[model samples]
Target: MPRARNTGSRSPARGAGPGRAGTPGRGQGTPAGRGQGTPAGRGQGAPADRGQGARGRGPIAGPSNDGQQQQARAPRRRRFRPGTRALMEIRKFQKSTKLLLRKLPFARVVREVCQDVGGVDFRWQAYAIMALQEAAEAFLVGLMEDANLIALHAKRVTIMPKDVQLARRIRGPEKGFASL
Candidate 1:
């Protein structure tokens, strides 16, 4: 039988050397030029050999390992004092409250009531306005209750002059009904 052919070799069947199977044959100096030479494989035997002294360097050294340890042990910084933070919160609340008051139409009535109650001081105005708003809310609730009572007790109803005036204003004079 014929000899089994070694298909892995690149050399012809005549005269091939031991290192000629996959090794770089001639003038290839760098490991990359060689077939099986990985950069990691080159650094495998001696780790310290591929140190900062290599051809291509990495990023500059940061604060040393010791410096990082010291920084980690350093005291934390205080962002704000408790009193200062409270004051800031109060000021923000006041600003938002003032903006809301300005946008509300009924805020004028509340302000007028505050003025009548001698709430001239800027700081005291907020409390005075709050009181006026509460009073107006109570008055509106009372008026609604009276209207409901009148609607429910229709038999013994007595309309006031103000109600008649309101009705006359709502129903303007017709074409020839003014003389009557």
Candidate 2:
């Protein structure tokens, strides 16, 4: 008979099983550490892994690639509604009128009205102040009416006549009479 072919001995290849060795296989046929070694150190170092981890943070953290693409394509936003815009124009008019009245010397107007209107030597300053207050009230009431008209027609049109008049009265010649 032929020799027993070492049937009773355990082979060294069998001892290289995964659990028995500390290092796993490297590439296809090279030894464990010969080429790129363990999976952890093969590509970039550990610091690169940490840097990737840090990037995935904050409120929008971990949005897939597609989500970021969609956000970039979104549109811009508008700041004001038609009704609010009308009111803003009226307010600008009111402010400018008040500024012009302030620059004029109302004391002279008061002195003249008192001297000319009443012979009893009444206070003209008080009358001038009252006139200014009445003018402001009239302007405010007109603005309110214009605002109402703008609101009533807001859904159907872009401009209202009452609003235009108010703008003209307040802005005078400075604003080139821009209509609402």
Candidate 3:
């Protein structure tokens, strides 16, 4: 036979429950230490009225209908590190900038290379593509800058293949620049 459980009934007495008598959860009704009908700030242990509780309207006024503090709460902490968030924002801006600049010439080739490589996870594939695109863009910008300098040195307004070849030669194998 199964034994019946004790399911005790609650009493309304001041010392009825788990906590100390004056504090909350000991019993129902208003908390034990507070006085009835006296305006707030006049109660036991309340801070002296800093001119706000005279009309019973501001910070010095005791706990309102609910028991929370009237002052503004502290700001919540971020779940991620500040640097990680900043980097994510920078990545978003970079992606937007790439879209505004028109499609990259080597994006298709990068995607093909990623596809041909084995053991590439889909999650890291986008990151890998972005990294490659950034490296390519930076390299092209540097090369163009150097080529423009060479063209200017030769007293020409336009950059020619020779200027680019000279820039590549100057960069050399040590810098990973290939001959045109």
Candidate 4:
């Protein structure tokens, strides 16, 4: 428990009749309702009663001196560390090539064969996998183009296996590319 505040002695007027002056009671000084308070310009006035509304201290809401509506602030830009742009570009390239590889029929087969190589600790990246797939596809395409030419030269529309063998032979064995 705490001790009550000792206001010294009580004045006679403070405990006087209800209608007496300088006393709080049913008198002319009592406020009526919501619209009643101390007169204006004495202290901080109520927002509803002020001439400038509630935005007295803030920037006025209207067009500027240039006769244009206030422009909204632009969104913040992304900041990257120094030398990280190359890393970001490499990741982007990997992602794009990975997406392209998804559309190729031999992508899965090539990835699996490289991963399943025996007695080797070969690790495959997206670039390496894509490189191998592209080289193989190019070799096949060139060989087929040559075989098609050979067939055309032979007065035939269909290419036989011998045409492909001849094409490979013409490419020579020293190139390390074996026959189909």
Candidate 5:
């Protein structure tokens, strides 16, 4: 087996040692470790270089990790409790308001509420939530229209609790949302 030239111990001087014809020897006429007369920084015969540029690191590679370590994750926030939850802030946009219920993170809160009610395997699906949101909006709009009419018949513009109650009764106990 041919041995790799013992370049480790050689001092970088121009034109020193038995030179490889192409790679200029350290301190040999190569201009301070410049490979093939290009530049000194191209990892020619630089004593400290290990040719890291040829094959780069893996995905998620960092200076601290050299493929021997797993990346550490940041700790998760504590579980939601009523008192602690009150301090947290959540942003909601005006457009989503028409498509969503007030103060409700429907999907996550649906799962939590279902779990509280002892539901077995309650997984929240996006399409199901979206459909339910639309259905609720439709039901509410129709109900509010009927309630407003009842309030108007009573010579009031503002819909009262009694107006909604009477509207539900008029819509009846069998097919109405009162049964729901």
Candidate 6:
């Protein structure tokens, strides 16, 4: 066992009453309660006795322009989906009065689509490709418009598969979108 240190003098724990002896028992804390050496939160002005909230500071203000304070604006977000941007560009092209450009799918995609859907088409014809391209463009336009409306209704910026499915239902009865 270790022996207590001897300094030729002894004192009660700091802030303990003069009548109390030895250090305070475990978890008993100071005789007066939680705020040992400081005053308890009895009133708003108790800080004077507790020694807190003494720092003198003023409200922080950012840099100003002239006499008018400038408000920060949120940065605009750019859409990432290739489909949305392409559709927007297509709409812009359609609205232009100066030039009318016919945007059709590349021959490779058309051939692949044919082989997958049409099948047994060993020989490709120009008229057949043109018809398929037009139909595909029409289906895409209706699908995107419907799906965009659905997403907007849900207060979301992203188009989900469910939105596309809903769009398909809307376009199911339409003549041009019958294939969809």
Best by TM-score: 5
Candidate 1 — which residues are off by over 4 angstroms?
A: 1-103, 112-124, 155-180
Q: Rate the local accuracy (lDDT) of all candidates.
A: 0.46, 0.51, 0.59, 0.59, 0.57, 0.56
Error of 3 at 8 (Å): 99
Rate residue 68 of model 4 by lDDT: 38
For 34-128, candidate 2 gives per-residue lDDT tens digits of: 21222233443333222232222323244575887868887867789658988888789767645334424555665576778876555545656
- Model with the higher TM-score, candidate 1 or 3: 3
lDDT of 1 by residue, 1-180 (tens): 565543444345323344543233345432322232213235342332232222325323445657768677879877896579877976786576333233256666555666889869333456665766666555544444454455455553454544444434434565212332
Superposed model 4: Cα runs more than 4 Å off: 1-105, 115-121
Worst 10 residues of 6 by lDDT: 51-60
Clash count, one per candidate: 0, 0, 0, 0, 7, 0
| Candidate scoring better on lDDT of 1 and 2 | 2
> How does model 2 score by TM-score?
0.23
Least lDDT summed over 10 consecutive residues: which range in candidate 3?
A: 32-41
| TM-score attained by model 4 | 0.37
Candidate 3 lDDT, tens digit per residue, 41-141? Answer: 34432343232543335565345765454345666887996579977976786676553233445666665666789546333466666777677777876
Candidate 3 regions off by >4 Å? Answer: 1-105, 113-124
- Where is model 2 more than 4 Å wrong at Cα? 1-127, 130-134, 154-180
